[model samples]
Target: MDVKIDSEGAFGSAIVTLEAGEKFVSEAGAMHRASPNMDINVESRRKKMKVYGVHLSLSESNVCR
Candidate 1:
């Protein structure tokens, strides 16, 4: 997998290239585009984990910017 980030801050858009059978997870709506052969799937986070009900924990800091 290859990652390229474009911007001058801690948060920016990224382009990723994955080889065959590779996998990646992004924020729920982070994906804006993908290659034609890319396989995209949306699955429940809780179901995938099978241990939690529901939870959302997010933290942001400007220290890296």
Candidate 2:
């Protein structure tokens, strides 16, 4: 999960570049601290069929919310 973000800041002066995996881990940690119920599951996909269901749930949440 390599992450690269390109965006102008409020002042539009500084450029920020962050690794996606690093950001997700950092955010997941903070979110976990604030709300103890959301379990951030980081799993390497072993099979397509096995992960399809999990991916569907995550995708649905992304759109429905």
Candidate 3:
């Protein structure tokens, strides 16, 4: 799924393109409006068997600031 957070850095809209054989059974949403500093929750169909590093992909707004 591709989601773009709003310009206000609050809520976001997403274009979920699931894998052909995969399905999104359920989802939980909250904080329709929130700032950039808000905590973000992430999920995946599979569990992490080992610790992985995080990659930073900052947008122009957040990066340039």
Candidate 4:
């Protein structure tokens, strides 16, 4: 797999190229576009998280392709 990140000012985007049988994983809602030949799957999980001394329950989504 090959990845590139492009940014201008405060905005940025990632471009990824994947070979056969290769997969990419990323946080859900992070992908704006993908090639038509690629297959995409989404998985969600609930877990406990803590930040800044605060406890939180979060549902996380992962995208795999």
What ranking of all candidate models by TM-score puts the best one first?
A: 4, 1, 3, 2
> Which runs of model 2 end up more than 4 angstroms from their true locations?
11-23, 27-65
Off by over 4 Å in 1: 8-11, 47-65
lDDT (tens digit, per residue) of candidate 3 on 7-29: 44444454333222323332434
Each prediction's whole-model lDDT (CA)? 0.55, 0.30, 0.35, 0.55
Q: Lowest-lDDT window of 10 residues in candidate 3?
A: 51-60
Error of 3 at 61 (Å): 42
| Per-residue lDDT of candidate 2, residues 5-50 (tens digit) | 4345752322222222222333211221212223345544546555
After superposition on all C-alphas, the RMSD of every candidate to the true structure, in Å, is 13.4, 12.3, 14.8, 9.9
Question: Which candidate number has the best TM-score?
Answer: 4
- If both were scored by lDDT, which would come out higher, candidate 1 or candidate 3? 1
Query: Which residue pairs in candidate 1 have backbone atoms (N, alpha carbon, C) closer than 3 angstroms, thus clashing?
Result: none
Residue 36, candidate 4: alpha-carbon lDDT = 60
Steric overlap count per candidate: 0, 1, 0, 0
In candidate 1, what residue range of length 10 has the lowest lDDT sum? Answer: 54-63
Q: Report the C-alpha displacement of residue 27, candidate 2, in angstroms.
A: 4.9
Compared with the true structure, what per-residue lDDT tens digits does model 1 show for residues 21-42?
5567776666667655555666
TM-score of each: 0.60, 0.17, 0.24, 0.61
